[model samples]
Target chain A: MTVTAKIDVKNQDISESIRKLLEDILKTEIIQAILVSQHLPMKKMVMPTLVTDPDHLDGIDPLAPAFPVNAATIAARLTRKPIGEKIAAVLRPCEIRAFIELVKLNQAKRGNIILISVDCPGAFQNKDYLKFAGQNPKEATLRFYKKVMDGNAVEVEGVELATACKACEYPVSENADIQIGLYGMKTDESILVKAQTEAGDHILKQINLSATNEPAARQTAINSLITKRSSFRDEMFLKTTETTNSLEKISSFFASCVNCYNCRVACPVCYCKECVFVTDAFNHDSFQYISWAKKKGIIKMPTDTLFYHLTRLTHMSTACVGCGQCSNACPNDIPIMELFRTIAHVTQKAFDYQAGKSIEQKPPLSIFCKDEFQEVVGIND
Target chain B: MSEFEPTIVAFFCNWCTFTAADLAGTSRLSYPPNIKIIRVMCTGMVDPQYIIKAFLEGADGVLVSGCHPGDCHYINGNYKARRRIKLLKEILPQFGFDSKRLRLTWIGASDGIRLAEIMRTLVSQIKELGPSQSKLSMVI
Candidate 1:
């Protein structure tokens, strides 16, 4: 028989309960260190914090609206080498997926990190979050939770959640060892707790929290949320495709790009230590520039804008996960996420693969299949 | 009047296209002095990034010439290059540059005349298209 568990939130605060959970894990040596989210000092923004001492978890608040960066890259860095003891790291669903991809690429290790995920309520962009917090952070956090648990999308000062969150289909972390459920539950009542893997089951058994069947209301809430997000994603895909179908149209779509490369930097899977664009490979001599300009009569300053984007698409499309961090990081607000997600959707589908879906699945380019794309190759004999 | 000349970066496989280019020179066949060939062991070693980098560094066009599909010196390098170049063709144009600026062809070591003909054709085509400026790099 499957077991479900609940925590009564009416009698206790969610943040305090989470702190206690981490404290217990720290004291028991299950995790040598714990990484949690905390509000920045004198600011309403939340950021990732690593804490080895349980006392430092007092200000940890994972429920804040700010998602300035994905925590997967952090987890990858933390586990790049063995640290002698396992560390527990909390992340959102997308972050966990990104981390898994990084691990498969040999950029990270799983032996030294404990993965903990939470039922994401979605988050706001950084600037909007600060405005929402205004002069009082506690009230803003309370309002944010109320809105999210009530199934109403939370907004920060009228700006909606980031496009990434609005279109996210996975609110529950499927790969997490320990999952803290928040969606589809009463904010004033208990939250659900579950173990998804052997590691999680072992930890839960040690924590000794009695299991109970998840409430029917919670299941209904979760189903409705997933359905809502799925439909939104479908609508977005259609709209993006219709707007830009060909290369010329897509180039116009990105005409505002100044080649800041923030999108590349923000991408979790773009792990190149030295990108070709930054090297001497793209540097052109002054005479070459003048000669080209003289020939063409005009040139776009700081050449190779289109080449830069095309190079990145070829290199990173296979690993794109539609996180929208690229779009979030853009100073020009280019719809880079939409373009990448659209192309990646088609490319990955053509290969019958999904980025970051499984560790066993090799990237399409890394391996060759004799029967792959036979029709396109005109080898349909 | 000065003749229209094109600056082409030719990524030629050592076994075939490079030899064909050398054969063209040895046969004294007249071809446009437009192409500056970079010899690679196999066409598969010519990463799409390298082609893009060439264009970014002011090469008006790039030609990736390798052995015939079934005749790659490295067994399957030409086939792999074909797949990669095909994908690059599909994707490069989306960034506002003409995909024609990047070309791929097969040339055997015996096909010195064909190599010269391809160079002449590419130089004329690039001249017609003029210099590639739309795909130029942007400084942050």
Candidate 2:
């Protein structure tokens, strides 16, 4: 079991307290910028923010229920080539998992960044968040925290949390240097912080937080959250699988796709610089159209829509983290996340691999294992 | 009406299908003149996007002919191609294109008559289906 320590919350605001903590880190020569969640000044929306100045930490709002984007891509960009100084990045559990996948892909380096993850209480989708925040964002945030901390379901404008968040199995970050504990705790007085690594232990030691045992109440809270999430995920799997089990059904399910390719751009892990779809390779001449129409009678406009998606599935299904950003980014509102998650569930299971689970495990496709996929490869016989 | 001559794009594997196509010409066997053959090293090397591109480029239909299963010069290239093209056929109809427009067949260097037969059938099928209207070029 992991040990946790408590940080007493004085009468100070949560954002201000977090800011002070970051400021202290900046004072140390070893630390560079502190990547945190902050509310934008114009909109009361909270998103991942990178703070270089101690003074700027005042805007940090990790508690706000707005996650416009995952911070893994940001971490990937930061550590791509390296910037001399070490930085501390606060990420959600999913983001940490995503960073793990990115690192495995050689898109990110782990040498410089300190990963701090908090127990995710789940978050609302973008539009639902705006509706819930209506007129008074601060009050909404406080209410949200209260409801979640009190073990009540947090709803935004009568809508439940995003399907992805509701079904997420990992609420606590498995790969964090430092972890912020929120579930099963007294929110008004204090919250727990646990260090999972040597680096984390060093940071916690410097901060001098009072040590505490893992509270029984905290375990109960975590169990309840995980139970709820698992049930939701199972239901989601059943619902999606029932909708399309065969190739014909699957094809029909995506029949409305207009080939907009929004899902591709929305996927953070889809790091291809030049997509095959957009290249000159897909550019067809006019006469070819007439010839095909003359033969086939009618060909769908925006040809190769199915091919484009299938190709992407083959390429990225094994790495899919089920962020639901693909569905969120679609203008046509296609249920892309459902299709991807369903396929990923099957593909990943076949390889006994879950994407973004661990940095140590390499992507199955990148390695050649003679004994792997024996059933599918028909090599077992 | 003008004689219906379907414009087909044939992606022929260099070692087998491409050679078979050459054999057809050298053997003085007559076949449909609709096909415009492009040589590739292996069927596995053909990206599904290329087939889609051929359709978009005004080709009435596409024929991807490679060595028979387990007979590929590259060992398992044809098998991989089969899996990819099979998946492509399953999923392509969702985007509104007739998945039938794309055909995958295994043709050996000795099977010049089989290659000619496949082309003749493809050309006739395409002639019945008419030209593809989904080509983005037609809109502008």
Q: Evaluated on chain B only, what is the TM-score of candidate 1?
A: 0.92
Residue by residue across A312-371, what tens digits does model 2's lDDT show? 976787888888778777776667887788777766775578898888787855654322
Q: Which one wins on TM-score? A: 1
Report how far off residue A369 is in candidate 2 (Å). 1.8
Fnat per predicted structure, each in turn: 0.16, 0.03
Worst 10 residues of 2 chain A by lDDT: A372-381
Q: For model 1 chain B, where is the 10-residue window of minimal lDDT?
A: B131-140
Q: Write the per-residue lDDT of candidate 1 for residues A1-381, one digit (tens) a residue.
A: 333566666444676666677787777777788878887786667889999988888888877777888888999999998878889898888888888889888899876787888788788777677877777765576677777775557454586888778888777777887888877666577777777777766666666466777667777887888888878888887888777764456656777888788888889999999988888866778898888677656666776676677678878787787777898899988878877876777667666777878778887667664434433332111
Going through the candidates in order, what is the number of backbone clashes in each? 12, 20
TM-score of 1: 0.83
Quote the positional error of residue A123 for candidate 2 in Å: 1.3
